[model samples]
Target: MTCTEEAKAELPSDARPEIKAYLENFNSYDTIFIGYPNWWGTMPMCMFTLLDKLDIILYNKT
Candidate 1:
């Protein structure tokens, strides 16, 4: 839907998208699932951002 790299996640940013309140219980789950449409042989930039942030969150807690 976009033809530019200026979009988020394509580039890292301090801003993070809002998460659902129910998802606050993230650690309660034993398994996590991720789904995204394949775009140009890469995941959407938002996935990159989410995964990057998730990694940081996981790292900080442990």
Candidate 2:
């Protein structure tokens, strides 16, 4: 799939979900895996949506 220049430039907040699901507590784990197909040298918009929802950044991971 291809995205327009506007979509690519948009922030994660503009991402839309294709399905409804609950995300587990992020603080409960030290490692989180995010998988997505490479589209135009960037991840799909859905991945950005999930990342945007996260309130904390994982730094100094063990």
The pairs that clash in candidate 2 are none
Where does candidate 2 stray beyond 4 Å? 1-14, 56-62
Can you write out model 1's per-residue Cα lDDT over 1-62, one digit (the tens) per residue? 35454544444554344434324655566788999978557676667667776676666686
In candidate 2, position 2 carries an lDDT of 42
Q: Name the 10 consecutive residues with the lowest summed lDDT in model 1.
A: 14-23
Provide the lDDT at 1 for model 1: 35
- Per-residue lDDT for 35 in model 2? 81
**Per-residue CA lDDT of candidate 2, range 16-43, in tens?**
5553674666778877777888856777
